[model samples]
Target: MALSSTQTDHLRRVDAIGDPPARPTLVPAERYHSPAFAQLEVERMWPRVWQVACTVDHVAEPGDYFEYRCGPYSVLIVHGDDGVLRAFQNACRHRGNALCTGAGSSLRELKCGYHGWTWDLAGALKRIPNRKGFGTVHMSEFPLAPVQVDTWERLVFVNLDTSAMPLADYLEAVPTDIAWCGLGDFRCYATMTIAVDANWKTIADGYSETYHVQTLHPELHRCMDDVYAPQMIWGHTGKSESLYGVPSPRLSGALSDEEVWDAYVYTQGPLMGVAEGTPFPRDQQGAGQSVADVIAAQIKQFAAGRGVDIDWATTDQVMRLHQYNVFPNMTFLASADHLTVMTSLPGPDPDRGELVMTLMTRMPAQAPRTRPADVHMSAADAHPGVVMSQDIAVLTGLQRGMHQPGFTHLVLSSEERRIINMHRNLERYLDLPEAERISEAAAGG
Candidate 1:
């Protein structure tokens, strides 16, 4: 499942490393905590951009539905009885009541609880309570307001702008770049909605760069190559690739091979079904095999136990994590046998947001799909994983720091270009005036 040499060459052409800007990018701090700015985003940005709503597993069978909410917008994604997937504005036409609340299966129709206004799974208006009250009501004229819905691999995305570009087009070269990994074979088994006290961008920026790996994620730093992890930017989407199962060059040869293995086991043991304190398999190390090769072998063996065949995946394919960012609020980190998609949604205020992680596991091609278990928890109670938990724990202080009177703007480096690219796309969507747009910081003497 590894990329061919030709494909790797193509990837090199898209790599954005060694392309640093003339100076640092300066983004206003108010964009993180200003209600006015958040309102502008809600009005102009959130509706038009493509966002990951749920996985196809959440709505595989007919009558299944998942309600996706962001800021003031709510979208109802449904699998119709006609075997087609569709989305609506999640509001009843009559009294503007929500047609659905949470995720569930076996939904015959969407009926407003407050009023009896009903619609079929296809979003066609079906009936209304006491129809005589409104004499001029027309069924065809009042179908549930449609929203655009599409799929790439197993992830479902929605856009309120029906005229928006197709999902494949919006994704640019990302789908093709990652096509060798067999992404569709991984099925989401669970999702955790962790409530955090930070702006959605605050949560998203955490995953957009590797600059914090050494400081904020000491354990992850011991295992991943923070440096030499190249990035790519293609319009609304971007990518970052970090090779795991190796000591970071930052450590400067201080970590032994066994130490690297231990770090990997501590930070991501579940991927290979290894326990936290498990020692490296010194005996299983082949004549010329490296720690990465040993780890890849273990992962393949683990997948085999679940009837998922990843023997075709090379060490590079399994150890190099392909982290992708879809502008605004979504990032999915994937390897040959591992996948985790995360999205940050605006909360009640600019200083609050929800980090939703859709966890996936590789399964046999013939394996049956099931609805993912969706659970909500506060940042304090969310221990999804060692690395991710650390990411969530820092949001509280980061949000508060953004409000400091002296903290005018966030200075960025070329390493954090993904975050800068997000702001670039965001400005285009919000149509911010020149004074409000992100700019280059003054050059240092």
Candidate 2:
């Protein structure tokens, strides 16, 4: 396929992470504003893509289940009595009624309350509840229809199009890239999910680049580089990533001592909540110590207290500083001690969408953790300001203005090459006919 102007810039970007090609095209705003366009995504894009449906912990035990809700399609994942994990169309095989209502466990069969049809966790039909009432029936033909389900490092993913590429093939370069982070052991530390009034892609795009950080999150500059240049914004195959930490290359010289500690105390200190959010001990050497030297000492001492050995010098980049956009709607940011997952899913309204944020960490092997109940945050609810509120305000504002006469498209930078690559990859899915997509996926794309 011939590259679009935007994609050609993306090809140029692949040569180096820090520089944006001189002339990336302006992205059309209609992609974010048009309901018809959103509907095309609903029909041609989302269904054909593989997405993280839920975490493995959501359905960890036999009979446990979680609803992978996207738009009006409610998918149910269950750890069945057969000791296997499975995904199925949440609708009953009979009369098209929903089979699962919400998430719960300890079930041997998924029984439809409406008409009493039931299926096993492996999606096998088990009962029709007085089969004579339906007269002669072919029970095999009435079993729950299955969705393609697979896992990678404990993330459960589902695809509605059975003909799309295998999950591993779809993941492309992501797995090996994140291997050093040891993500599998990072338990769910905290999770927050909310429905919102913005397009899912808009929210995904918000996290795709660091260009807006210096303007939107200046406080973070104290500890991490928000500068777009000199930041390694590498992309390969179908995935992309960028890192934080390492003082901004734009800084003329090494950070002053005060700059190091001030940045540390405000950012990493507060984040670690060292001594319950008070200033860290300052016990480490205070005079003439480089940032790396100070950080290396602190990590060694901290890990010593926790009875673990971490190669901080070698794996320092993993020290709470890397992130990746997992195509479609999932973004994962990992620190040495934790991982944050952000997801954007189509909303009930074409112009609006849903957002989910989950914090995964291993700060303490036995930290007290709880997954919070899903809540609906109003558009006006910018309670915990800064990052969340600023992003919400801007995206909602963009949503409102995108359709206006003055605004026609997005003027993106090389910093947002990830977005360009993402949209083009989406086009691949959108262009294929549904039957062909399924066939291609099943044949191992």
| Index of the highest-TM-score prediction | 1
Output the lDDT of residue 110, model 1. Answer: 89
State the local distance difference test value for candidate 1: 0.90
Checking candidate 1 for backbone clashes, the offending pairs are none
Tell me the deviation in Å of residue 289 in model 2.
4.1
What is the alpha-carbon lDDT for the whole of candidate 2? 0.65
TM-score for candidate 1: 0.95
> Over the stretch 1-445, how does candidate 2's per-residue lDDT look in tens digits?
1222322232333322455454545666777877777777888877777788777667777888888878778788888777788888889887888887767778878888898888877887888887887889887887787888898876788988888889888777778877877777666544566666788988888877767766765555554545422223233233333333334434525555456455555555533334423433456655653454455556556655655445543424433355677678888876565567888988877678877776555544454434434444665753433456677777777677877888966766666667776666665656744432211111222
lDDT of 1 by residue, 1-445 (tens): 2333423443354333457788888999999999999999999999999999999999999989999999999999999999999999999887798888898999999898997888888888999889888887889999999999999999999999999999999999999999999899989999999999999999999989988998999998898778878888898999998888777767846888789899999999999999999998999987767688889999999999999888898888999999999998999999999899999999999999999999998888888777799999988887888888888888999999999999999999999999999999999999999888999998779
Compared with the true structure, all predictions reach lDDT values of 0.90, 0.65
Instruction: Tell me the lDDT of model 2 at 278.
Output: 46
Candidate with maximal lDDT? 1
